[model samples]
Target chain A: MAAEIKAPAYRQFSIAPAIQPGSMADTKTFVANEKIQEAIGFPPALVDDWHDRAIAKMGELLSKYRSFKVYMDACVHCGACSDKCHYFIGTADPKNMPVARQDLMRSVYRRYFTIPGKLFPKLVGARDLTREVLDEWYNYFHQCSECRRCSVFCPYGIDTAEITMAAREILNSIGYGQKYSNEIIGKVHKIGNNLGLPGPALTDTLEGLEEDVKEATGIDVRFPIDVKGAEVLLITPSADFFAEPHIDSLIGYAKVFHAAGISWTLSSKASEAGNFGMFIGNYQQLREIAMRVREAALDLGVKRVVVGECGHAWRVAYSFWNTLTGVGSGAADPYAMQLQKQLDHRYKQPMHICEVTWDLIERKVIRLDKEANDKHIITYHDSCNVARGSGMGDVFGGQFDIPRNIIRAAANNYVEMAEGTTREQTFCCGGGGGLLTDDLLDLRVKGALPRMEALHNVTETHGVNFMATICAICKAQFTKVLPYYGFDRRTVGGVHQLVSNAIRLGDK
Target chain B: MTMTTLFAALFYLAALLFSVGLIYRIRDYARTPAPLVIPTTPAPRTVGGVAMRMAREVFFFESLFKGNLWTWAFGWLFHVGLALVLLRHLRYFIDPVWDWVIFIQPFGIYAGLVMVAGLAGLWARRIFVDRVRFISTPSDHLMLALIIAIALSGLFMKFVSHTDVIAVKNFFIGLLHFNLQALPSDGILYAHLSMIATLMIIFPFSKLLHAPGLFFSPSRNQADNSRDKRHLSAWAAKLESGK
Candidate 1:
């Protein structure tokens, strides 16, 4: 909460944000406490022989994750991905460069794993795994948002996110946990959500939401929790219950579900969709968090599982949950088979809320009034994880189209940011990859520069008042950082917020 | 050892290191487990599509084309020209000059100049561009310089020095037949060969492994089927069994 904006306070707004190299080099996140690490099932404190253990973990990862291993050897330093990182573009720290950041770990990888680094380390840019190297790993690895924008332009598909994850995993293995992400993961394990909000509080919040909706609209709009035999169980980020703008999207989801006449309920046991386990790059922790949803769905007897608008959570739900739990295709796996058998085979295992909304709009299951949002010209900010990591609807690029279609149905005026900044080449909100905490405010502000500049363009040219995104982190980041750049903090809202305001409730 | 014997043994040693070391590195990459599907979308979903993507990346430097144009131009030139030159050199290894090699000889000669041009452009950026310069290490510059030197020396042997082509062919053929023969003694020819030998020795151990690493990269090569198919690594599978 003590986080404040640090900058050339106000950057000269431009269509394309200027690259200020090394602007965020010294930024560091708060270190994790023993309790937070212990809660997430890691070593509670830094070990005496952390260096040895760290190297051993890297060795283990090298064998376990092929992306980490191949990428370690793949970089030719052709400098293709050097300028692709939004952090590097915003902060200008040479280390923020994707290639340079990977070298932080690659150098050490060369030293121990490859033959030449053991012999002539300098000749190949390889270095030993010294204490200084580990410190560099922590600082620069956390600086990366894991946005995967760099991988879009990387000739060899060397995802710095994969490397960043591998580095953080290595750091965590040595008991050097990042406070923000580790603490959030701990809260998630203890209370079933990141904010540590209790079940009774969640119940109260849903009740309040129901009352608020009824007050706003003359009709009774229901927001239910733990209703057995519900066809769909909606798992949203807990921030939807606790935070602003995020709560508005929660309202939107309820409206869409209400109009579509789906029997849906929220589960206190699986109230969270955002998984911080991914931020630390721990598979065990990631699996543990995913299991909550699987268990909740089976217990509640929900045939269809729908994930709410949360970025990396969507990626985890859309991509990893199938294998991590038994949500999707992984039900074919013997362990996953039990849960898979319970899930309705008629629907997509975990449908994205956008996909569900888009489907209803397509089939005329829900009619929407575009005029309700006439006062607002909206532009969609693609959340990096959802844009790059997950797909929507049925096709390959339904991820990009479905949300935009839903927006077009909900609003008359829509404009795209610059071609490169949209779709697969989209920039990070600068607050992703677990750097959304207050300790990294310096970076969070700077990182948002590229994205804010893009948003600034839409406002200037298209009279766009709202920048809608699906991720809670992006909403929180833009809402927080927009004020520093002389824009209203209310400029950022969720994609569903647009849908909520425009849905025609009176019609069949 | 005599000069012919020494050079013959060196080439053999370099070839052995290059092939065996490259195989070991490639094998390591192939064996590593990719636990999740992480293709950078919109990625090809099928095997043929992946091959097409790889082809575009190799032939056109598709991703680099999306990045900086200057980097792409120079990078593409060096790689494509290097391919031509390598193919052109196949004339020396084959018994009778292959018709394709003979046909490409003129273009291959031009490709040597293009290779030098590409290396010069790449090396200049290393010194001039702030971001590129910052990320580049000492070896990065040296790599460009080493390739430039090889290109320049090879060009000299082609146009300026005129090394004994027949003798070069005989020497390689003899070497291929396990019979040592006199190598062309031109200093430029020796310089080109020595640099090439050095490059071969470093291929697997250096960042040059990007050549083989491209094929194994999970992000590029993976199908975006994580939602539709369950991808579990060997270690991850073990975790489930343990659970």
Candidate 2:
């Protein structure tokens, strides 16, 4: 077979491996896990003009949406945010400049959606939208990791990630969409979540996990599937089932559950909770991903649902659950009904992994031997979508301490990058939105630089070996980006790995 | 003997011309608000791309000075020198070059050379690059030409034109002190003094204000994160109403 002219690993999350005595000479070969590739069900390249219809609709929808008005109106354009962008900080490439990325989409939005833009293109400096401009929009918007680091320094708190999402939504409406995003959305619709594992695949995976746990630690760790009357339904990200670093996180959750002696089951129907719709700006898809989890709990009679460590998933689950429940008749939505039935309809239950993890720690349900998990000197990468986009500040009390506490509980030493590096001020890994796919690698790494620099700063002084994060995409991003920038998996992984290792699963 | 009265009359006339020029420029901007905004390099394509693009251009100047290292080096020196020269003139308004004043004055002259070279290169690029020349306004050329003239006159007076430095200083001190002393009677000093007065009056109304306005314009000052959220600009709202 002709060798694939492999693209360079440019962004924060795309995998690049160090040279060693190995069969393959390139880094891409080592990091490309064939199983995870199959797990995502990669789609065929998009057809031309596939997005024209969607873009028109988006032009109309965005024009009407009041929130967009608030967003565009709020920007005074102080230029304070440019240096703060991880991508611009990383590459020093002018195109990679965050403001440049936003301009590609903003000008079009102005041209089509604003009266000032339409009447006097020359006056407002707005240009007519052409096919070439659309292509530029496609290339640049996807490049945004949708990291909200820009918002931290922005005086008005204007978020470009939101604009990227809005643009993707518009693009999707026109049929101009990334196969990676659509394939994931397609999986949620056809199966239950982004990972497209059918009921059988999910059941088999859990069964296999049970065997692995029993072998690794001489304990009967049951990964019950669709078991009725369970108190909790664990909603794992598809990454947990497929992606290696995330899979390790899943094992961590399993061990934590075992040590806590909690009655939890993995529902085959809603095995995955990640919704690419969040990235693409499709609320319907976002609803579907959440609906499956809500339905799985209903179908199995579970009382609570424990979300996995996926950043956007946790964000969508928390922010949109109520809206989805209220939309189209409150009870008509099966997802809301299941939750209402499980929790006595009086109080709305919080849906997030952080909340669940914090609760578990607070309850003192599981005993942790912090020293046993001390192999890694870990630091947390707070996800922008969670920390800034969705008001995650109050959700975890003050700042990034919750994730830190979990790390501290799992290990002896916990470190931080800088004051403005995480939580509300965390730098993006540059692979958010739909930039996680292989196509927008250049833009992604360019955007990952600020966060990478922050990581470098702390890691250099503290001798911190590993970078841990709760967001699945962050893991996917940092895992790929760290190596290219001269860091490794030993330098980055999910927080779940710590929990899994620290949980006393008994002697093997 | 009555040379001080004649010099005072010339200064008033020059100041009036400067005021009229500024008013015309302000009126031009107020009329359209379009010239104030042009399709600059970092035109935002995504919703918040404008903010992000604007931010980089405004603060880091990440777009202008990045990668092209030599241009950045020259540009920085020039801007610093120009600023220092402007500040040093304040010494003329005072009785004498106070303690530590002479130290800055010489440094300013040296820095002025960097600014002159940087501006010359940029002006030259405008003529050389097809795209840049295509966008170049007559005003842009005139502004560059005038700054070069100002810097040259100042340089000539300090180094080449060896005019009566004491007499010129006394003339400036008398003007600020309101005595309006007689002109120094040196052709070079007279030309330099006239040029300095001319430049000051034109400063506020020119594109040079981009130095300050760049910090406020959304096109060059914002980050690109707003695409993740919905942004509805006031202009969009107004456009929707007409629809």
Candidate 3:
């Protein structure tokens, strides 16, 4: 089903394509079956009263999330964010425009919530929530990656991602949920990871990785899991255990911990760092998913919780874990205070692996032989969640700088992509926000256009052979979609993968 | 009913609706719980820094400036000019116009021209730009038209069809003091005042709520110190307690 779709070509400049109305209207993702929905505590199937239920969910969201409430009223339709969305830029679908994507739900919001729409609907572009509109919501809201790129450009900080989250939440409440996000979330709840890898399998994979690393470097670097009293509990995405490029990053983290001599262990209980509850925008589920990590930390008695190279996982860990599960300080609740007292107050709780690696490099605790990566000229792809949604170190924009600093220290030659396509303005890898499943491979390939263009630019200008990122989704998405765009699958990898290539393993 | 009495009644009603409606909407926004810290980073980590960020967004249209130059130029000009024109209009309500208001009288007259020109550019973009045109509803166009119409008519009274300025001032002062004063009988003057009344009455209900909504927007106004300060909302706190 995905093969027939072709990749968009790179132009001389990143220009906005002419509006193609309904170009992507038929591009719908797979819907959650009754079982998948039921697993996640959503309605098993579309309810008879879905129309009313959807509206009620939206009202609940408006009162609960200020982002949803203010964004609904703040948009002036000035089109400042029209061309900012990668999906819109890639597909040229008018509805893919952040403002238009927002209007699908906004129109319904106006009809039900606002006075002007109640009095005169057409004039304000408000419409009743018919089944057709619900289907439209399902199709278009899934099309969004919730990357928050448009929010950066909007005059009022009108985050279309917030609207997308709310729309998905409302859809799920009424028994219309996307299969990819719901299924993974259910897996996280049931088996502690998205890949559903159990404790034995996780242990086997780590032992295998340790053997592979020892064979290469002749050093006894360990991939310890479920080890109680470890100083740090490393919670990473399950992709690292099973997938290419991501596995290489997992190697990097282990080597960093070994060279620095910091006692760290992976927890099978919280094996997965990626949380799809965020993608579906269900706070209860989001908190519930985060609680697994808390449980792991408490049971293991780890002093610090560190997250690995996954974008949204970092966001959930860094920005949300503190509030969601008391991973950080300042929580007055009993559960939070208990966890807080156990954690080392000196270190940032639930720290990014990049922060840990960079701190080691800065302190000269870990030495790197940069010439080991001499064959590859690297560029960093700022993961959308990390770039726009979360921070790394104490400094503002440490998320951007820390990753690049690691790359520069680990690899001698590094180049940045075009200005706007890097840093806070970076494009999404398109497979983020729960669109990483194979069923949406066509949309994934199409949405990769903007970032692919930026990469192509650097390849042409600098002969850049490697694109380093700090996201499992980015690495996975780019690996699969790079071939479609005439680039090598190996072109995209993790920042730690480069660090793994260059870091001095023993007695550094 | 006399023209003076009819306009007086309309202005009072418009004022009442604008004040009450705006207060109600602002209160609703203030009361709503923001469950999590979702500030668009690299955001400021301090409250003062957030205030500075908001100030830049309000005064300089910082995000829009980052977004599109054409939109920012026109939008900023319109807002600044409208502010000057609004301040100038304070001369009507004040018994003895302040020294600064008297000082900026000529600039205020010129600002009216600037405001309309800026609105014209924005309206033209709405009509011409494909993406903008696609997103714009009739209300968007009408919102632009309404403001532009008010600006144009106000400009017309100053430059083209001259009205009795002293009598107009006296009429506004009379309305404030609960006394009736004769309004100047001019077509442009009536058009200008009534359009303003219409704008005020619709301000709280329409997308003009962006003015207050911007202040409440979590992404812009929030400090990015979520790690240091645990921000647990009431509903979310209940969930924790329940657990």
Candidate 4:
């Protein structure tokens, strides 16, 4: 299936392609089946009255989220963001343009809600919510990674990600959830993680990782789990247990803990830090998923919570975890206030693992032999969610600088990708926002064109051999699509993977 | 009714619709709940920082400057020129026009030309740019056409077929006091005033709401201090309170 889809060729310099209408109109993700939809509390199938239900859902969202209502009204169709989308640049699909993609639902919004669209639909481009429009919403909205790159460029900061999430939420309400995100959300709810690994399997995976690190470095680097009263509760993506590159970062986290002599344990109950409810724009589900972490934190009586390397997971953990579950300060509700009281006030609540590692490196709590990673030349890929959605170290742009600072501290050679493609302006990894399933491999490969081009340039100029990122999805997506573009799949790995290579295991 | 009375009635209706509609829309935006902190990052960490950022966006079109040079240039030119032209029009309503308004009269006359040029550039992109043309609806085009026509008609009155300036000023000043006064019956002047009225009537209904909407955009206006502060909306707080 991957072979059937060709990757976009790497361009010498980045340039937006001319608009090609309907170029990717046929590329749609698989719709969730009844069991998957119902597992996550969505309707089992498309309701007979889906049109009215969808419109009503949209009305509810418009009043609920200011981002939705304001974005729907604020756009002037300036085309500034038309070429900012990677999918548009890669596939040249005009509909892939951020503004055009938004118009899909905005048109429906105007038809039902606005005066001009109601009285003169043709003049304002409003359309009825037909079956065809819903399908189009599914196809194109899923194509977006919810990366927020276009938001940075828009004059009024019109974020299409907000619209996409709201559209997905409305779709799920009308019983039209995507198979990948819905399935995973169900798994996270029921099985404690997206991979659906049971407790015993997770324990076995950790035990195996402990042995692997011990054998490789002749040091006892323990991967502890579910130890009550541990100082820190680490919530990482389950991909860390089940996947390569991700597992290496897992190993890196263990080594860092071993070196620092800190008591940190992973919880089987709240094993995953990611919340797909954010992807679907379901507030109830988002709060529910986050409540597991609150439960685990309260149950274990841990003072601090540290999230591992996952883009959207960090976004949820850093941005929404406070309001949803009181993982941060200033909690007002009963549950949030309880959790907030239990957490240590001195440390950042629900800190990023990079923040943890960087703090250790800065204070010399753990030492990294810079020459230990001499074999690799590294460039950091700023994960979209982390870059644009969250921060670190209590400073603006800390998310950007801290990881690169870690890479520089660990390795001798560190180069950056193109300027525009770094920091807040970074491109999506193509497989973010729940489009990482095998069904959307073609879209994934196409959407990765911009980042791949930037990476290709760094490789030529600086001989950069490895691209390190702090996102589980970016690692997984790049590992899969790198080879399609004639680069080694092994070239992409985690930021801590480099740290793992360089960190001194025993005797500080 | 005479053209004067017809226009007087139209202007009164337009003023009412514009003010009431704009107020209603602004209130709707302000009342809507922002349940989470979703400011695009590298965002300001303080309220003051966010204000500065918003000021830059509103005054300089900072994000648009980051986006595309052509669009930013034309958009900024059009908006800035429109502000000047509107400010200069204060001379019509004020019996004793402010010294600043009098000082800007010449610049305002020239600003009409600049506004139309900017609007023309924006309109050309809508027509010529494939990506833009794909997204442009008939209303988008007609919105531009309407504004450009308004600007051109104003310029026509100023430089080509001049109207009775003192009489126009007296008429508007009289209207401000709710006293009926005969408006200048010049064709270009009537066309210009009618289009301005049309724009005012549609101001709240059309994309022109983007003006006030920009202030309410959470992504642009919110501070990136989510970790330091927990923000919950009234409706979301209800969920937690189990109400």
Candidate 5:
């Protein structure tokens, strides 16, 4: 009877990472390994021969820093950092211990690199670096969301996330890397976006959405796709184009635009705002993607670029965007990164989608009809990458509150998840760090159980039928996991979706 | 030569080594910079719960009280009793009499009892617990043995032997003020002094340095609210402007 319940189909399409630039050809050649690599192309790595290259690169990178030497010198394995983890605290899994989690990488790193290990070996739990160890590194290191939460509690401030990131980079250098990240990087290199669906495809998607809006409301909404003189270039997750929940967000964006009578365009060149390289410690690729998006904005003559609901996408946009371009590249200011750096002193422009949404409501440009979204009981899921990751928790807290306010304006009841899942203590959707597309479903499901459990608690108690989120990937993950955990799909939608449903479509 | 003078000479030399060594080591630490220190949650200054945090630390050992309650309980007891014993020993340094030191003697003996019990509990915990045993290096076990030995020897002089503490006090006082002194004729007291010297030399290099460090610890000392705000420390500001 249990076997009759079909193993839930893992949703791979909507949340897959952007692939690498020069990695697809290598993925094509291998036989059995190729099948595994192709099965989850989001986390693309070199097939069979990748291990040799990884080992060589590990030596070169390890030799460059005294920090790794210090890291090797430290670590008493007191296990002080184990139970402090939210996952371990929530799950009570023994292997989720931070010291134990890090031992997977540290043991291999010691065997191949350190002196005592190369000499005595057995005294320090060090072992010979082998293909098996590399396999372990691939499995375990990717499990970390690179959240930096564990480091907060560690007495030594020893960041296991930093070690995992370094390990991922070492793997990437050897051609063992994520396919989706590589693909997106390749797109950034070639067409200035991760979505590989280039300028014309983006325009077509926008134009089609325009027609959808026209049919729904009888309002002639023009989604300006790369209009040269536009004041704002609105960018968002690639998932919003075809994905169910975020499409409603796009409609909300259109309605807001119509009411404000503001000139904005979806950049034909840089349609997708997410940069997955930020997750894998490939700072160069991260910078390159940001550069292309900024270049598109500059070339098309938009004064500002507003990013959408993705978390790490906003992090890269806010944190690294300015530093990597302009003076870092010795080029003229690209507008977006420059605006962020001098938020107080720069041009009186630059805004995120959430900010713009609140501004439209504040200006009384868009009048929302209160009865449209009154049927379902909804609650907000704060994206870690959005709230804390991008250093916009306060800003997005207010912004996220605006969406819930709009929902409450439509309906009297909106709820919050458990204690630690809001404001300063929000949890990451298990699919963060391009792990959403990696072939680690068992790990992802187990890791995401906390979030699913929290959501389930809300549903059982408050009859929360609607799970409203801002990020596109959050929408995609919920759509896939909610049903497996027994929550209906009709309950999940973007913040903009609620806004679109409630806002009067035409002249009120 | 007078026996008292010999005692003073020996006492002065030991005191010189301890005071100078402690100060030198502390100075070195003060000069060294700790560049990164990430603060954790519910730090003393930041907890918003209705209960006072210090009350929790004193009563519950809130932060020190961890998932492994038995080990943590022993650790907390050991630390509290050890701190009191050290304070009681301060009587040796003062000349004439500080009324408070004499007042605290009975409390000191009680604290010693707690320390002995806590040390035994911790030693047993290290031996019996599976995960603790697995991660316990030989050095870890050896360090515990050294601490237990020191604590027990001190406890013996206090409760069992009842050695001539007057002579010991005189020796320590002469040493603190730089009068060289000979050992008290009691061999057990000499053994206690020797054990204490060994512990002092080892203290700087061992995990026992956590005693002084726990106070400076960014996790424990600083406010957690600083992370959300752009907190510019004076030193940080000076460095930035200098750059």
Candidate 6:
């Protein structure tokens, strides 16, 4: 079965992270290779003066970003966010606390930037920029998913994600990078997808999806790729083309497009939506990755753009795409002006597939046979990047409701997990912010503890045999972590996967 | 210098340090670019809506309320009480005290009590709460100690040993108008004045800058109109346009 990944269990986490001390400090991920670093225009390897270069980069970032400078200074160490992080709650590592994690950079920032720290570093607990501090930054910063859960609770609105991103960016500048995110970014640039799936491979994958849907429902649902003059360019995660349940979501998107009668095609040049550049906080690389979508849209002459099920990709698309490349209208700048003129202005630019699907369901354009999903008791896991960083529909909290509305519409049985753990205050799947690699397996499994505990409540009470989400990373991470917690790996899938099983598609 | 001249010179030095330091610090914060729209979501989409959000955060500690309640209560008490007490201090600087400042003076004493109590509760949390204690540094405790000492000394000068109000008022008014006068050198008053001077001198350099820094926090202040409007920082624009 596709659920079996053929890897040994790193550790079984039946119990959640006990609120003890120092539970997760020793864990680490693989380091990026020279080629991966060079591909993204960073240093090929660590130089002899890496410390000075890192300090210089930190200085550059403090001047260039207001949030970084303000957050570094604004923290009063009040500890409001000490227990807000799911990783901290699950693992109980003291450093996992958001205030402590930000202090890693703040201490250095003070030593270099503030007069008191410059004169009496020890009095303020400020440390000189040294090799040991760099090691600590790599260890703890990667443990953070950049989920921004801590930011929601912080009085000064100090976002540890911003600090973590800056630290990662400096780490990369000095030739220290995570193997997973850097490699994926390089792959996205080189082969148009994170998996390095070639144009011909993508075509074959789409063809296979078309055949699978055709055989299952005996309908001619098309999964077209690189079709010219299409109305919508569907930018989705590359994992959707290969992974088990993610592939199921791809099939679901094809079915929805067929039913809605919208002309859509996946672009060969910009097949991936998950941008790893945002993971490392490198603005140049982030912009370069996002511009691919615009390049694909402009090259293919598409009128509208829609994103598929992916978490951080949606954040980048919803929050940063416009500034990076005028993907949306109303921006007066040349970058936004040029792209806005080309995109058909009648539709919302870069709509979420869930929003589009929800809209169609609302108008009764797509009918769902709820009985088809009766066997599965379903609950939704809010993707962190989507829940905290982006919004959906026209309303403010529409991001939370639209996905549940779609789930409720498509499935017969739906139950929300705890109220505190759902909606805007959701927990990450432990594998977000580009820590979704085999190297960070220990952290990912342990990070999945708090979420699993929340899921346990719904699973036992509601008999929720299935956990549905809209992000590809959440789907993949849960599939990996579920088995570690005695749940079947097959229990996790996408919201669209449920939609695929329930949608009655012949004459919509 | 004589004791009177020394006190006068110190006041002038503190005024210069506070004003110049605050201006430059605020200038740096304003100049730093916010390159992304990262308001924690379900955030407001309009500028006016953003103002309301910040008002709630500053006045009520909205996010902290959602976090730990005890921390919120203490934090709120400290901040609100500090606000009232600071407002009540305007009576000394103005020749004819404003009616509002006079009305607040009664509550100002109570505010001083509340502020000390809140600071005590917070300090206890730092010493007793494991999560808080783990995050608290020596400087964190010292920052609290400095503020609490200020509040207690001010209370002592008010209720325990009184200073000559006329002389104190003349000294502040003279300092305000650049007309030198001998400041009251009462033991309690000296302790209180030096602490106040220390706070003002370190106002821009210390974590106390959070007083103004909160206003410019992009996460709290930025609108959730990322889809409707594009926000390209100068550095980002230069990079994007060239590419």
Chain B TM-score, candidates in order: 0.97, 0.66, 0.98, 0.98, 0.75, 0.96
Q: Which stretches of candidate 1 lie over 4 Å from their true place?
A: A1-4, A7-25
What are the Cα lDDT values of the candidates?
A: 0.86, 0.60, 0.92, 0.91, 0.59, 0.87
Interface RMSD (Å), each candidate?
1.8, 13.5, 0.8, 0.8, 9.5, 1.3
Winner on DockQ (4 vs 5): 4
Each model's Cα RMSD: 2.0, 12.1, 1.0, 1.2, 8.9, 3.0
The TM-score of candidate 1 is 0.97
**Poorest 10 consecutive residues of model 1 chain B by lDDT?**
B1-10
Q: Is candidate 2 or candidate 3 better by lDDT?
A: 3
Candidate 6 lDDT over residue span A98-171, tens digit each = 99899989989989989989988887878998888888899899999999999999988899999999999999
TM-score on alpha carbons, each prediction: 0.97, 0.61, 0.99, 0.99, 0.70, 0.97
Task: Report per-candidate DockQ.
Answer: 0.69, 0.03, 0.88, 0.87, 0.09, 0.75
Q: Which ranges of candidate 6 are over 4 A from the true structure?
A: A1-22
True contacts kept of each: 0.76, 0.00, 0.86, 0.88, 0.02, 0.78
The candidate maximizing DockQ is 3
Candidate scoring better on lDDT of 3 and 4: 3
Q: Give the lDDT of residue B22 in candidate 6.
A: 91
At residue B126, candidate 3 shows an lDDT of: 94
Candidate 1 lDDT (Cα, 0 to 1): 0.86
Model 5, range A83-141, lDDT digits (tens) per residue?
44434433334445566567666666656765445664565567666776665666556
What are the runs in model 4 whose C-alpha is more than 4 Å off?
A1-3
lDDT of 5 by residue, B1-243 (tens): 265564454445555665675565455444433222223332322445213543454455554344346656786788789888988988877877688888888899889889878878877765765434545555566666776777777888877888777767777766666665544676666666666666665454444544444433333343432222233323433433342
lDDT of 1 at B109: 89
Encode model 2's per-residue lDDT on A1-508: one tens digit a residue.
1444222334454211221221211112112123322333322233355545545765555444433333443332333454556655545443444555566665566566555467755544455667666666666566566665664454333457667777776655544566677766666666776667788877788789889988988788887777898877778678788777888888888777777777888877777767676776655566556667666666888666667787776656544554443211134334334356565332124345555565677777666778877778877888876665442323322325667778887799888887756666677777777668665565555567667767777778998888888888888877776666777755778887888787766641
